[model samples]
Target chain A: MKDPMIDIRNLSVTFNRGRKPVKAVNGVSLSVNSGEVVALLGESGSGKSVTMRSLLRLHPKGTSIEGSMRVAGNDVTELSARELADYRGATVSMVFQEPRLALDPVYTLGQQIEEAIMRHENVSRREAALRALGLFEKVRIPSPERRLMNYPHEMSGGMLQRSMIAMAIACNPKVLLADEPTTALDATVQIQILLLIRELQKEYGLSVIFVTHDIGVAAEVADRIAVMYAGRIVEEGKVADVIQNPKHPYTRGLLGARVELAHGRDRLITIPGAPPDLAALPPGCAFAPRCAEAAAQCITDVPRLTAIDDTASVACVRYA
Target chain B: MINLVGEPSPILPVGERGGPAQPLISVRGLLKHFPVKGSGFLKPKKVVHAVDGVDFDILKGETLGVVGESGCGKSTTARLLMQLITPDRGEILFDGESAGETLPLSEYRRQVQMVFQDSYASLNPRLTIEESIAFAPRVHGVPAAKAIARAHDLLHRVGLEPVRFAGRYPHELSGGQRQRVNIARALALEPRLVILDEAVSALDKSVEAQVLNLLLDLKRDFGLTYLFISHDLNVVRFMCERVMVMYLGKVAEIGERDAIFEKTRHPYSSALLASMPKMNPGERTLEPPLSGDPPNPIDPPAGCRFHTRCSFAEDVCRQTLPPLSRISGAQSAACLMAMTNSGHSRAPVQMEA
Candidate 1:
């Protein structure tokens, strides 16, 4: 509890390309202690996924990352190719949005999972196979033994996601990074997956960084939420505190526009315009264009994230 | 033929042709079964029961929401209504006139339009926003100049300024903008019944709210009825006046939005409602309301398709397929417990109470 398991400090990632580089992650600093789950909430182009992907050092060549990213006591940016390979699945694992694309179609699910296990540790094929079945049962895959032989195409979306979860925890990873795991599934099935992830996170006492765009989902899963807007963290707080009394104007707009919250109202109180383009975002606050409370200062000077209390922070001129 | 009364009071099936309270579109025993591949040559032909024995009434000037899992045939039902696919059996009556028989197919089609989920694929890349909207109207005997004029008018109505967006191609616009253009195109023919199949499911939170409000305005101004299909329960509840819950191509429950959302009768409906993420962090869902994926639709469970997953399912539920019958004032459910005499051991006792 003294030090966070995953600490990202003053990180800035830029895509090195034509003319000006695309600044994807700008001065993002977040920390997750052991067994704590923090949801990085943002709409598209907000760079939530990019920040999570940085922990694994998965960015393409020519991309430059500044500042420190420490996961499981290892400096992620300084890790070599061989060290990164060993650190990835054993120390931290990821559950991607689309399991169909994340999983290999050519091999059986059993083969893929067993291969990952054996690569991480010195285990025999038979032992790895047994461990795979155990992981499958933990994730509640029906008829685990038979399902192990089925290809990725044979399973439903929810089933495939369960298999993905099973594979993710195959190595007993310390941290699990889930990027929109339940976005594609049906509502009935989505709840099941969310519950399973929560249950697994508890049983394993794993630190988690869940990236999602849906606020309801963030509330349901994460202990803390970091709201991102145009490559910047606009607000960070406990899920209840942020939801009950949102500090930032953008977070307030998000909660107000939720259809469930607008139950009795005839017309939804929508934020006027769309999210700003990340590549060519204007100066000052990116959300100032659509923010109802954007003052004259909000249009000229960018607001820094200022802490309001022990568990809450907001990045707006009014709060700053 | 618009119903001036916005309230969706249950208009029971009009047994005769010229009943006073005729529904805009009435579907009876709608069935469509797609055969599984490589099932031939002396083998028993396997069929995926995409839609079977479904019946509903889309009331005039009201949004009827259809919700289900991916393979529950919600989209199949919409396609059947649009004549995009031919059904194996059943009949669809438009204003008491048998569709394609008394009422010409083209005339029936002209009054109905559909907006799909993928905003980009629905429109052509080469055509500008004005041309895409004008194409549909031009196809139905409208002159070139008049169709283009109508298109510009529709773009303005859908909140896209014609002066700025009329000439832009589909690729040049954002996802929200493309969806607005698609909505404009759907309204170009002045469609009376618009089927929105996950239309706002792709947009962001703020954009979805804006589009939903726009949809309400259009519906009120045009006096249009909507058959809205979606997987998101929250969005469905907000947009729809009446809601229908389908499970494996069968109507588990259908009723007024309040009754379905509040006084839910079917086990499946309750499970679905419970699964919606409560927007508050204080009251987080402890247990998953339902577990396991939907059973294979190719060979659905015997009798009641939902019995395998239903918590209160009994032997009788496994043996007998319960009929969808009205239980409350405006709510109907196709569950053994809801059927007063459905011999599910607990039905009669509950019914008496």
Candidate 2:
């Protein structure tokens, strides 16, 4: 196979390394080819968002990152300060969960998109504005011309999200990183945003990494899913296989715990205990304490992610 | 038509619990209109009809799910039921007694408690887990020692050990743990009805499952009723025996869980169900089930609040307010299309330009 559009190997990110370090992402390796969509699926503090944000090196100054990240064959972590600026939107762009926070409140939607375009390419203000308008239309925003003048607060949550998506793709980045883009929108609007992302990805042949805590949303959009727990990828495989026949205990627990899957059951089968704290995770497997199938080995040995078949891999004592 | 004024005879016979067939909580013509800003001088005052004419009944020991998008007044309805805010024009009957009239406000409040979405915000930061849970019971005249003991037991029931967690402040606990403590506090007063306003929405999926199960178990043990309000259709379906679908502060549909999910009668409810992201990849919806956000509630569409977005909306739907008509046993919908059985006859309205 050709080189993946976005590639990361042995990626690890730690915040506030001196006093009390938080290991946000640990030894996560993933790749997405052109036009492919890989969903980083996990609950809060599971490192899905952290790992995706690493592609653009968006962490604070004191944070330490140890990883090899490549997007469109450009080394991400190795990029110089000057090169990093260009690398951010030209090679990859991100859509944040809260558009209100991500967007500049004072700036109109058109201004933000135009600024994003102008930053990447040598273009006149007029040209950038035209590109921004085109992007608005492409993302299916109603009355693109009128919407461009509306400030971020003027637009609804769904509209702001679409504007965010429109900005992310303004430069036509090789890879799109959507970090729970639809989480803040309503259910009906969430579906619209999800379908819009999928449609835009296919239309532009863009490789996308969509991060979400929702299994249903992941199932709907992702071609492959990488399930994160604590700070590691516990399970990774095709959406259908991983969801239908999960190998990892955590993945199985997530599926079993889904309220949608609990339609006929009297009681939902829940994974006992809470997620391990990222600041001070437990020894051995992070999920062992909550796993019903945990054995003695799971408590003592940190299992490595091993391929169970051609399409799937699981990090568990059972698979290891 | 059901009388909106002084209590009429019970709609159904006394239920199995030997109570008058009257529901534990019956809401009628509930309306809350908040005056909008910038309406004093040149412009006529406009009122945001936050909870416009919403009516429903919560039978004893039953979970009545309220599902709608943000601004659809699900939270307002919960707030109204909790008496956090009084309705402008409507009546809430608790156990066949008018909430604030026949039933004293304090008495009604004692029997009804609310759990909000943000657990941390709802909890008092100054109080420990035990103190937070015990405070309510103490206010209700329970002895301090007994309330403390009850708090401990309640904490344990919610899967939080009192020995380790009782002394911890709200800030020290995890999101899920704080939520459990919130639930424990809600139950501390021994309330018969608990209104969970997006209670489990802020937790992780796994944690949400645990809390949901705990809620169900508590319901069975305490014979409690729940008004579960959430935007998550799946969680609502799982938790609620009867579901109410709201749109623009109005009841679009209300029915048994199966009727609402399997044999939906309202266009809005069907759209809501269809909008749920398919769990199966093969069955992924090609197009968005519905387009656009709900229209502003300040000046909702002339007749049916949902007519602007309803695919089957007609000229009549725009001018005539459709009453909630019985679709089947214990299932009803407020839609002209449903009443006329012409849901599939007309093509869906074209997407707004």
Candidate 3:
């Protein structure tokens, strides 16, 4: 098989290392092959965003990261400051949730896209501007020329997100990191954006690590889904298998809780308790307190991500 | 405007006291327009038609879900029902009396409470959870001690133990907990109708489910009516008995949940339903149901508000506004195609095929 475009091994990231540290991501290992889409599904504070940000090394200065992250054949953890700057946006790019906040308010989208291109590539200003227009057209933004001159705020939320996607793929990165890109968009516009991302990913053969809390969206776009609970990946499998036959209690609860258009269930099955506090997580399984299938052993021993079948792996004492 | 001294009082009898079986709240021809600031003093100021010619009825003890994209005036309609903003035109009839005419604004507001999307912003940081919930009742002339006791009961009802959480400030709670507190506060007034404006949108799926179940239980126990406004179609479908779909400050469709979801007639409603990302990976959306955003509210299309992005737009659709017409039992849509069956068939059948 071809080498994985992005390989993360035993990745652990903690904030405020010495005093009152928060282990945001604990022992997460993920691999994304070229042209594949892996979704990291979790609620707030489940370390889905933190795990993705580690790929770009975008965490705050005090964050202590202990992990092996190799993206596009480069050790992300060992990159120097100069190399790191070059790595971002060129090797790996990200599309954030709120494009209005991510984009520069003062600059026209054209200048920003041109800047991104000129910063990384040895292209003239005019050539970069031309490329930016082409990128806009590629993303199917209407009137690409006029849209290029428009400021971010002038465009609607969906349009701004499309421009953001256009900017993210300007450098033709190998791996794309999208953190809830469609969460802020309206429903009709959200489908357009999701389809655009999927189309661009296939066109470029980019490995995508899409992070979202919506299982429906993950199912729509992801090839594989990794369910995270309290900073740990409790389940990882092909989207169909995970949705059809979920092994982990948390995954099952999430599926049951999902409000589907087809199903008219009276009450959604809720996971009893909130996610554990990362700073003071419970020993053993982080989800044990909320897991209905949790046993006495679940409280005392951490469950490793063991392969349940050729297509799936689950980190649960029940599975063990 | 002369009044006779012997005229009977304008106030209608309260809550099914010998009155006909009328909806609890009825809105007709509601319109709210805000003037935009022009570049210069001489430039003709444009107007943003935030809520333009919207009409609906909310029966007592029924949950009516309003689903629409942002800027579709769903929030504006909610605020209008709460009487937080005055309408430019149209009347709001509450309990068989025109609100602000026979019925006073204060009484209208008392009967209709609102819970906003941002729980943190809606709550006071300095106030404890109990104090926040108790504030409304206390101001409405309930005794302090009784209000406090009621707040404690409400907190317990929302699954946050009053003994542990009552004394804690808003900042001390998580997003879901803060939202529960917000819900409790909305219920403090014993309102007949509660406007939930994206209340669960900010919560996680698990917590959202818990809150939705709690809301259902509260609705049943208290006999409360709800105006559930959200962009999440699934949640709206699950929580609402009846649903209203809006497009650019106008009612696109309104009907029973099953009628709206299963046999939708409006092109816009069908497109919106088709746009929902499917849970099955094997079934992908073949095409984007609708392209581009809704047209700017300031300069909405002359005919159908949705024609700009609608795939079934015909020449007539761009020239003449379509009045909402009933398609089947309790299901109504304001689409030229659905009304006449002339252009393309409704968006759902076309998309499915």
Candidate 4:
């Protein structure tokens, strides 16, 4: 295989919360290829967002990140403050969950878009404005020419989201990091936004790290899926391989838990217990208590991702 | 025509005691428009048509699921049903009486409960779960001890250990547990109609299922009526007997859950259904997701609001608004193509613009 666009090796992000440190992400290694969309699928506290944020060194001040985190050819972990600043939006643009919050309240939508463009490129205000409007047009923002001057609050949630996407793609970044980009949007809008992102990805040949709690959204856009559980990727494989024939018990539980539109479908199957607390993670498998198929070995040892088939890898003693 | 007034209350099945002869809640031509300043004083115009002409029946003891894309007015409709916001036009008949005239909306409030989407904000941080649950009953004249005992029973019914959770504040409980308290509080009044607006949308999948199952069993044992509103079609399918699909402040399609799911007639409904991710791999249809965002509800298209994005849109669709024409068996859709044998059929009106 050709060299991946982004490579993450043994990356760990630990948070110093007073007395003891909390490992939000632990020894996670993942990669994204050119033009591929990789999804981080897990529940709210799964550390997917932390891992993705670590790519750009976007974590809070107290969070300590270590190991090789590279995007394109640059070692993201080794970047100086000034170098990282230049590379931030230019190399990797992030689209957050809430568009309104992501956007500046004071600046007009047009000004924000221009700021994004001009951040990575030295251009006159006029040229940046034209480029911003053009990017807005690509994002399917209606009447991009006129709506550019509108405030973030003036725009509808859908339009604001599109504007965020427009801003993210402004620098022509090699990779896009979307942290639950559509979670706050409605279902139809969510679908439209995901489709828009997919189109932009194809058009730009950008590697995308789409983080979401929704497996459905992951299935829609991701070429590959990584099922994260308590700061680890327990299963990683092609979207079809993982979704169709899930090897991990956690993955199966997630699949079973999804309610389907089909009538007379059995009551949704639930994995017992809540997601583990990141601060006090269990000795072995974090999901063992909730895993219906958990074995005696699951508690004794932490399973590493082993190849189940040609295209699939799962971290489960049962699979091993 | 079934006179919704005389028809069995959508919340209650026929032959059940205390079940309304008509739907527990009958919303007819409900329209909610929020006035907004558009540009200037002379032309201070524009109405955000939040819930535009929505009509649905919530049967007693049955779950009526409302599914819509965001800003489609599912939440707005729930608010209107709760009478949290008064309708600009149309009538909300609760238990066969005009909600505004027959009883003080507050009295009806006891009989009509609501579970909000956000569990954290739903409960008062300062108040314990016991207090939150008892707040309504006490105001409605139930004695404190009686209300507390009742709240405890309700909590137990919702599967939360009442003794442990009773004294805990909303912040102390997990997302799922707080939601259970919300459910328990909503059921405290034994309301004939309970409107759960995206009640479990924020929950993890397992937690969502647990809550959904709890709701199902609650409906069975308590003979409770539910207006389960959500953006998720799968959850809607699991909980509801009948489903109503809304788009841009209008009811796109309403039908029995099976009929709507299996044979979706409306193009918008089809598009929404097509976009949902299916768990069964065998059922996957390799269609690239829906293309465009819904047209602005404020300036909804001349004829059908959805025609702009509808694959089967015809000349008549652009020219004349489609009526909620009956299809088969208690199902109807506001789509010209779904109403007609063919889009090419010559009619009094042409579908093309």
**DockQ metric for all predictions:** 0.77, 0.82, 0.68, 0.43
RMSD to the hidden true structure, all candidates: 4.3, 5.9, 5.4, 5.1
Off by over 4 Å in 4: A18-20, B1-21, B37-41, B104-106, B278-291, B338-353
Candidate 1, superposed: residue stretches over 4 Å from native: A16-20, B1-20, B349-353
Q: Pull out the clashing pairs in model 2.
A: B13-B21, B14-B21
Retained true contacts (fraction), each candidate: 0.77, 0.87, 0.80, 0.48
How many clashes show up per model? 0, 2, 0, 18
User: Residue-wise lDDT of candidate 4 within B1-353, one digit each (tens)?
Assistant: 76767856366432234444557778889999887766446885787888888777787667899987777898899888888888899998776788869867777887788999899998999999999999999988999999999999988888888888899999888999999999889988877778999899889887888888788878777777888888888778888889999888989899998889889878788778777755443444354346656666667778888878776667877887777778887799887766655453532244575
TM-score of chain B of each: 0.92, 0.90, 0.91, 0.89
Mind giving the per-residue lDDT tens digits that candidate 4 earns over A26-125? 8899988888899999888889999999988887788888789778999998899999999988999899999988899999989988887787799999
- Tens digit of per-residue lDDT, candidate 1, span A1-320: 48799999988899988887899988899999999999999988888999999999889999999999999789999998999999999999999999999999999999999999999999999999999999999999999999999999999999999999999999999999999999999888888998899999999999999999999899899999999988889999999999899999999999888898778778898999898766787788989999888888888888999999999999998887
In candidate 2, stretches whose alpha carbon ends up further than 4 angstroms from where it belongs are: B1-20, B340-353
Chain A TM-score relative to the true structure, per candidate = 0.98, 0.97, 0.97, 0.96
Error of 4 at B151 (Å): 2.2
Compare the candidates by lDDT and give the number of the best one. Answer: 1
The C-alpha lDDT values of all candidates are: 0.91, 0.89, 0.90, 0.83
- Model 2 chain B: lowest-lDDT 10 consecutive positions: B9-18
Best by DockQ: 2
